[model samples]
Target: MCTWFYAEKATLSPIITKAQQLPLTDTIMNTMARSAAMSGNIRPTDMAAVFAPNKQGNIAVFPMIWGFTVDASPKPLINCRIETADRKPVWKDSWFRRRCVIPASWYYEWGIPPSEVGYHNA
Candidate 1:
């Protein structure tokens, strides 16, 4: 499960600033630049940066709440197994209707144990 990830503020700002030059994307990109300077570890339910298109069709980069609620478990869904998404009613409609891109500079792997801490690798 991709429970934790990171975003690079250094490169992200400049990139967004440049991309904002395109028509219809200036406002959203500028907004993203103002608050996108987030670095270090991000956990489930935290506000993390994601890139997605709004109803207007302009690409928007903003911080959104991670994970979605599910009735099967008390914990929020932080990951999805793509292969079975079509058969799952909870994720089917969303998987088909919505599209999102999660930007992460790095991700952590916990091969040792669930409780033990793990380090982020490039």
Candidate 2:
């Protein structure tokens, strides 16, 4: 499972602004800039800018915590596989009802490092 993600404000900002028909406020832009700079990787518990439907069903930017918590584990659940999401107890409700779009360029997998696994840019 991937617990880390990356979002580029430069790419996300325009889409959000256009959707809302307004420029992103300075505060929101500054916050995103700082957060992205503080850690290139956005991990569980980190605040992230995500897109979700509002009451009117219009997409909007919102600050969201990166994961879901469960009693069975000390760490939060960051990823839910589609194959098991509906069948799994922990993800059942959210899978059916709650949803949000995370605008991430890419994510890192757990365990073995990419370099050790011989991954390289083409």
Please provide, for model 1 over 4-52, each residue's C-alpha lDDT reduced to its tens digit, 9 standing for 90 to 100: 7665556465444443344434443355333233344556655556678
Local accuracy of candidate 2 as per-residue lDDT tens digits, 26-117: 45446644232312457776666678888898987766667898889988876588999998999999888879987776677765323423
> Residue 46 lDDT in model 1?
54
Give candidate 2 misplaced runs (Cα > 4 Å): 15-39, 71-74, 110-122
Best by lDDT: 2
What's the lDDT for all of these models?
A: 0.59, 0.63
Give the TM-scores of the predictions, in the order they appear. Answer: 0.63, 0.63
Clashing pairs in 1: none
Candidate 1: how large is its RMSD? 7.2
Clashing pairs in 2: none
Model 2 Cα displacement at 28 (Å)? 13
Reference-based lDDT, residue 107, model 1 = 68
On a 0 to 100 scale, what is the lDDT of residue 47 in model 1? Answer: 52
Candidate 2, 53: how far from true, in Å?
1.5
